[model samples]
Target: MPVDSTGHAIVAEGLRKRYGGTEALAGFDLAVPKGTVCGLLGPNGAGKTTAVRVLTTLLRPDAGRAEVAGFDVVRQAARARYHVGLVGQHAALDEVLSGRQNLVMFGRLYHLGLARARRRADELLERFGLADTGAKPVKQYSGGMRRRLDLAAGLILAPSVLFLDEPTTGLDPRGRNEVWEAVGSLVAAGTTVLLTTQYLEEADRLAAKICVVDSGRVIAEGTPGELKGAIGGDRVDVVLRAADEIPAAMAIIGRVTGGEPESDPDTRRVGAPVRERVAALTEVVRALDEAGIVAEDITLRRPSLDEVFLRLTGHRTDERAGERAAEEVAA
Candidate 1:
């Protein structure tokens, strides 16, 4: 289904949230087009969860406004709920209920007739590869199986917009891939999605556009390629034979590339960005030859999402101190 170009599936302007002394969201803004997947990528305590809660009408924002599926999240809470589905980090399943029953129950809750609900349940069971296990109690299912059932439950009503929060957090690699495949199919079928994840690779793989939140605000927003390109130019890696010659190699590489070469103290490797690959490589080789520095290996690579985050925030995503500070502020 083609979405209206003038309308937005999700829109927010100056959204803000506060918890006592903490500020969870500070003038946050977002716009997600219908039939597209927008990713919310951040480390823990970056307000990714809070933003999702507010947009889904689970929690109210302190300031600003938001709309979901053409309904105001606050003023038209029930209408917004009718058109959106949410799958949180943990599997929200009834242990005693069978997989098919779970989907039917949710379908009924959405006001579907018994016949239509059953039909939808059957379709979802088959689509999520849970047809064989549909009669089994959820308690008997594995982690992956339970997660799939939870996802199926969310889709029972054929919601127009889906909110997925760390959908693959606890799943194995194969399970994660399965979920990704399902998400891709949903987008192809014209269902918009808002995904939140701490995994950089997950965001890079699934998101058409990524919004990076840090300290309760969006610090960066763009496609994966755009964000990587923003970090500027290609990177060249040089592995030296001797650790002691790292400084000398850095000096040579830096002069050649016209950029400061960063050295890895542990691995004795050096890297720098270069605008002209061939010219920089030639100059680097010549300079290293004069300095008696033998390179064990040389390769050119593009910047990864990790490097992009580091460059933008001046810290890695896993840094506990920064996360704690953010939590404290958000709390």
Candidate 2:
């Protein structure tokens, strides 16, 4: 597809990369619309980091093409570099430098004049909510403060595209929210963002579109709600009064819902998929009543992103060892 001239911030096609014996990326493709946020999510070792590296020009792709901010990632790498900002998983701040000094240092690296660099540093200190701590050494800053400062450093050039790789890995709930708020503000002001995160909740809340990667390939892509809808309809959960009655409950639920019923051996709970939640609930309760099965609890809810991931990959995000082995082979 041709790149859009108006606001196509990033376009990548068939991007491939290898690290010695391992293949970090295998024909990966991505297109990020300008002025929007796209969340890249997958289990550990899913080639997310490798893809980001290639797009940001940190690592070269063996084959394929990519453009960032209208500049080719390979032939015009320097131009691409100037239009992008990266906030990596680790804080890239110098512990000995004060927050204000760190920002100023990055501004100078971006080739800003000394006077302009100092003015930008002051502006960022306030924007990132670090105005009061600007003079403090980074070593004395809290984890959240350091993270904010690191992000401020990336924004020194005011690049059109920003890449955030697990920006809130170890932060508290409040700290995470602060970062999320900043990201939201940036998007609102027309900055394109490509964010990779393991947190499903983070993707669900912030991503305009989500791309699920596994084994260095794009397995699925869609809006959060669209992916959930594709997994089927609402879930009807029935809790039995007696543990021994699980088998009996499952049989009745299957017949009533006309769908496969899954049972938990320990809790005597059964769940089935249903097209209509209210109708399914009513039918399940009446059927159980007729079968002489007592239901202790009943609830209906939509499928979560966790379930969606499992249904698509047959494994959850927390299944690390298997993913690592797959990644090693792909890499």
Q: Per-residue CA lDDT of candidate 2, range 107-165, in tens?
A: 99899999999999999999999999999999999878888888898899888999999
Candidate 2 contains a number of clashing pairs equal to: 3
TM, every model: 0.83, 0.83
- What lDDT is reached at residue 300 by model 2? 81
Global CA lDDT of candidate 1, please? 0.83
Estimate every model's Cα lDDT from 0 to 1. Answer: 0.83, 0.83
Off by over 4 Å in 2: 1-7, 233-242, 251-260, 266-306, 314-318, 321-331
lDDT string for model 1 (1-331, tens) is 2323266898888889998888889888888998889998877778889999998999999998888898888999998999899999999988999998988888989999988899999999999999999999999988778778888887877889999998987677777788888888888999999999876667778899999888788899999778756665567889999999998888878888987579997887999987787788878888888888899888776554455567888877666634432332222
Residue ranges of candidate 1 with Cα displaced over 4 Å: 1-6, 233-241, 252-260, 273-306, 315-331
Deviation (Å) of 84 in candidate 2: 0.4
Candidate 1's clash total is 0
Error at 98, model 2, angstroms: 1.7
